[model samples]
Target: MERGNRRNALWLKQVIVLDSSLLIAFKIKNDSHHERANALMKQVVSERFGKPSITSYIFDETVTGIFVKSKSLRLAVEYGNELLASLETLEVSEEAFREAWKIFSEQRNRRLSFTDSSTLAVMKIHDIGRIATFDEDFGNIEGINAIGLV
Candidate 1:
């Protein structure tokens, strides 16, 4: 196979966990990561890559974060609903929350948010290796790699 085709095939085998930072960047026009997030969206829509997934907690975080940062409940609700309707949202069980809480409690030095902890928990559960995010913290993680830079 040609190099470009090989890259596309590899991309097809990957599943990316959608992080709040990328979603927020796409939802808000003025966000620093907007352009890169837009490019990622194009890839998703073009189906050149694997479908994206997000945990229920990440969904909540993205929606709430959008509202908090944008100060517009309408945009938040609209984007939240759109994501729920479109994306493959992973569930957050008690076990998952417990795992996330454990990580949050233990990672005092990392300052990882409970929401980010939930993302980690969900990604581990689903065996996902890549995260669509602008945050550098994901880069510090063991199993997961972050994509979609600012």
Candidate 2:
């Protein structure tokens, strides 16, 4: 029904969007979702299902997550570089980016960060219906589905 490769496989969440949580999980071995995230990463790289895309904002979040976890700026940078090798980065206009950031910041929900909101916004904008993330809040978004659950 999707009219692409796999042709009739409508159950698959094609055109996946990468999330910072999943990336962080992949990098941190001790993370709760590490194994699942690692397996998802392997699938993304090996199977090459639709070009997995991430926003610049999410990229920053991921790198920052790595830094906070490892407490090493150098290691964070290295991990960011290694992680970038597997996905596509999506860039948006400054005004749009700022607006999304502002809207998410005003929301009082502690579980969903500004970065998570931005990830949702980007997914909506690009029609990316699936994401690789541990955040269940993503499922609340109308059109986006977060995969890679452990």
The 0-to-1 C-alpha lDDT of every candidate, in the order given, reads 0.81, 0.73
Can you give the lDDT of residue 10 in candidate 2?
A: 37
- Deviating ranges (above 4 Å) for candidate 2: 1-14, 98-110
Question: Mind giving the per-residue lDDT tens digits that candidate 1 earns over 59-147?
Answer: 99899989998999998899989998988887888888998999888885586888888888877765678888888777767777677
Highest lDDT scorer: 1
What TM-score would candidate 1 get against the native?
A: 0.82
TM-score of each: 0.82, 0.77
What candidate 1 gets wrong by more than 4 Å, as runs, is 1-14
RMSD of candidate 1 to true structure, Å: 6.4
Lowest summed lDDT across 10 adjacent residues in model 2 is found at 5-14
For model 2, residues 3-121, the per-residue Cα lDDT tens digits are 67445243234567788888888888899888888889888766566557678888898899999998999989998887678666776556556766875877655467777777666
Model 2 per-residue lDDT at 49: 60
